[model samples]
Target chain A: MDQIMSNLGLLFEFPIVNLKIILDGVMIGSLFALAAYGLALVWGVMNVKNLAQGDFVIAGGYVSWFLVKTEWLQSLLGVSDNFVILLGVLVAFVVMGAIGWVCYKLIITKVIERDLFTSLLATFGLAIMMAQIMNLLFGSDTQSLKLEYDTLYFADGLIDLPIAKLIGVCMAAGLALAVVLFMKTSRMGQAIRATAQDSRAARVLGIDTEKVYAFTFSLNAAICGAAGAIIVMVWVIQPFYGITYSVRAFVIVTAAGLGNLPGVIAAGLGIGAAEQYGSHIFGIGYQQAIAVLLLLIILIYKLLRQRRLRQVLQ
Target chain B: MKLKFATLALAGVAVAALSSTASAADCDEIHLGSAISLTGKYATNGVHAKNGYEFAIKKIAENGGVKIGDKCYNFRVSYYDDESKGDRGATLAERLINQDGVQYMLGPYSSGLTKAIAPVTEKYQIPMVEAEGASRSLFNKGYKYLFAVLSTSEQYLASAITLAAEMATANGKDPSSVKVAVAVENDPFSLDIRAGVLEDAGKQGMKIVIDEKLPRDLSDMTAILTKVKLLKPDVLIVSGHSKGAATAVRQIGEQKISVPMVAITHCEAADVTGNFGEFAENILCSTQWAETLTYEDPIFGSAANYEKEFKAAYSEYASKKVPYQTAQASAAVYVFKDAFERAGSLDKEKVRDAIAATNLSTFYGDIKFSDSGNNIAKPMVLRQIQGGEYNVVAPSKFASHKLVWPRK
Candidate 1:
């Protein structure tokens, strides 16, 4: 009857949409991964989730927005508009690094080895406090940076990249690569990585593991701040949206698994794109629902797989 | 020594009795139970409502509380935080009614929470004074005990269509080709608004290009923004979480989408808190009060004063530098006190009937309950944030300035 054909119609229609969904998922997933890599860096090193990671990004973005609109950077440094972005990224890096250093030296350092729960609670508390402070300092409002890069147009309208998004993607990629290079090559980065794997072993090998941990946490925060600056080029930054970004980061790290930077970056882009495509298919109402569903499925799948292996052993 | 001790004991007894009579003669201390959301998402709305009540209580006490033929009663209030949750709100309402034995109660910040606690109020026969609630079903349930100070979501969203039609003509946009994309919150108030918007769309010849009811936590709106961009609609009307609306605004900006935005309900309030000064321009929204009200407004002239005093007293309680809930709360206090005074007693039925007869002006507005115990037709004002202030811009008469349309 109509039910069978309508059900059959979906069977025919789902493949075309399935491909589109996957394609869309990959695009948004990558972006989620990128944002998550920032959090993962902090988590893997200092064991702090960086609750204010998204806000730091948002604040950096507002700074960049001010730089672009008021051309204050041009006035201050006599830099061209082309150099404003580079200046913004550098500025965000230093500012966020300093903030991280202060936050750690004063607050986070005292509670580092207390317990996992303490760190989690402290960071989450810091996140809310920082959000309110941001509201007080800058107010609860949307701020963004406008760029002049032209949109990337493709045939068949399969992919149309916004100029700002293209720039954000490139900046995020470049920063993420720089982070990878530092982790791989730099002496401090090596010490941090060593400490992440084993703090006792790192200390035995003549590394000041405490310093490395603190620096790593700061570096992670700085990277997230830079990401915030970059993201505002493509997305809106709000004071209260730190929680959403944190959730997005959590989903990415969990979905892609830990320590996978490229996968993390891919997850961010994939999430952005999935939301876009999912909204198109299901009407934007179920966008968050889809992400929640994906996260739940993956989490449950992992749990079930582990259970099955346990059963086999028994 | 025994005779003197007896005389002194008698004197002490007389002093104790005299103090009791003196305390009774004041007859001014009236206890009110208030259950409001003091934290979480509903904190801002609850704090404001609480402030409105506080301001009214202060105003009344200064005017000798309330006069009931001869006796005047001063007000004292007790409150609990609902945390913006339905179960918690109902639990608090029960405690306020059963435990505290308050004759009247104010609050239940949202429709979900209000509806959850409505039965408790009915069971207790406590005349509940409602403000900032938007669910119409609360009134339609035939609960004579329930009363509201404002119109519900149905009337709120119906204004949107009328606004669109009126705005298009005034702004030099073609009314014939006006397209509205309704992106309302998935909440009950928003759902009702979405329905009303769709219902009125055909009448105004308003084409609904995108009718979307999104959840409050939609952080990734790229697809929705991209679709709305592709549709190239002239006007985008979003009705949802205030923070969500603010995010939509920033997303629209990032995409270089230059369409005028209209938000309904609490989203407008969120727009104020989320957008702040620089980015608050040109986004039209409907609200109960405009911060930039004239001297005639009961609360507007004193808003700055209230802000200063409230911050001094309840600094740890509230943060945002805006007013709405305070007016609702303070005025409710005044109304409750005035009505109780008119009724001449603290009896629940008499107070309910007196509250029903509230027709005069107060600190918030001229509030009067209809036969059904809701505001007869309390108006919703359309305001836009300009230079960090919410300016009234619609109904022409209440407008502080002419409409600022999108340049494109």
Candidate 2:
């Protein structure tokens, strides 16, 4: 009885505390939602899927980190890590935009009239090449930028949030709102929507559809860069990090469906929260299993739903 | 046109025929081959491993290498990047052995990659001086030529447990009374380390609150952080993560979990996370190499100066750090270089004997490769990340500070 009682103490003594975890998840997940917006944008505006969006974000993070560490941008403007990150955002968008434009002009345009499979393969090749170039240039060590943010003890009980995440959360919300406004009202945004809805009709209206694709890609790259800059304040950067983050973004993109911002945000938040809960219920040992399980569940559901529809049609 | 083509073809044939005959002269130089990763997912580990061997290669060449009594022969290396894949690693290993005729080898970044290349090493009968791969089974596989210079996961994790207890006690806490959760990255190495922790933690009467395996490349560890905070584990052990452990520490600090955390296998890269600033303090980790010892030792000071000159010359090439890889790599090459000199011959049997007889002080500590080529003397030390620098804290002989465990 004594031994059993002690073993029970191991099981229940440390109940999964919720507040700190949920808040941290939401705060971090918001950035995921923000970065996911970039992926959704390029896929929506340009019919070309960008497999290198996460690498673009990683590039952005590195740019800001380098600028702050090396004082490279000191002469142009006096700025802290925030300013550097903002600059990184600008640089990521511009550089990736140029790279995307060059990529399209060189390879994608050749496959534009071909099947979708050709374009997908081309984009994948681009992702791999970009990853290699990153390895070559950055040399694969995990690097992070520091932020001077205080930890806020809002309540005595449990919710202790890092001020950095609080800032990042607010910035992500602001960025997401900006993306919404741009898509709704901006002229280029309207051109992108027109091309997305009907590419021929947009060109007939003098939308310059190729320019729209390039601009949209640039915009997508810029948003990813912004996310990267924010992440540097909150997370760490490794060379292959883009591959992992890219997959995570793709998950939200698929779950949320095409051009649905709210759905994306919900999916990101839900995943972040669920991973937290998973750690609680299953122990930290199985947190990653949650994502794999979710992927499997969705896969099974889709298969079953399709089978049911096929039977009905039959 | 036919006559002109025949004349040009004759000249090309002469060039090739001459070059082929000249290849025989290459036999005078002994080439050490390695199938090290310099690209792909685990690119960082590969690149660092390459640097370790390079430092040795440079030293060997500078000293006119392999003084087999009367003859001082030039030693060289033919390296190819395996990109951290087993198939690629094995192919490279075979190419290095069969095609290039490399006799001695140092390699193969991880255990999985090492295991992949093990059969190739055996087939070639090349004596492999391996460092990096800590899979016990890699050595246990009854391969006579394969020798390792570091601790396996079981040995390394035992050290972590001992240090954890000592650290808690040093901080004036009841080391025996605690809820310790074993959180590890879900890989062979991580599983080995954390499983060891659970076994030891269970025996020590520390409640095993959580034991979970995570992905090797998880970008977001906020959820894991939140869970650990909720569990309020006195210690959270995230071992064998190539990249995620730093983020775990940052997230834990952001949430102010205030638990004394121990990150296994990745305390080496903590210096790069200046973004976490002072928040990264008191985060402890274990590794095979010691950086400051090189800075502090007089013998290493000369080597350090040599490294400084090299770094100054090669700053444009790569990131600058007294990397953990450099310590192991430089040691690997020096071990071979010293052995060849001591053996008085470049013969395989003699060099093998010399390697087994090696008992010398290295950057980490005193190192002596067992007859099996495993470093029996090198002990894994526990260190803490303070202001982005990993300061040794566990062993009293080398520790810079008494271990401090933070409590909320």
Pick by DockQ: which candidate is best? Answer: 2
For candidate 2, what TM-score does chain B get against the true chain B? 0.80
List the candidates' TM-scores in order: 0.69, 0.77
How many pairs of residues in model 1 come into backbone collision?
45
- Per-residue error for B347 in candidate 2, Å, reads 6.0
Tell me the tens digit of each residue's lDDT in model 2 across B1-408: 999999999999998987555433332576788888887767877876787677656555554555566655655788888877999999999888889888898867888998998889888777777887777667666777777777667666566667767767777877677777666777777777776677778677777766656666655565555546556777777764546556666666666767755555565555424546555677777777655443222233444464564476457435666566556766677677777879887688788777778777665466686654567787777777765667777665777776655623
RMSD versus native structure for model 2: 10.4
Error of 1 at B186 (Å): 3.0
| DockQ score of the complex predicted as candidate 1 | 0.21
Q: Which of the CAPRI classes, incorrect, acceptable, medium or high, describes model 1?
A: incorrect
TM-score of 1: 0.69
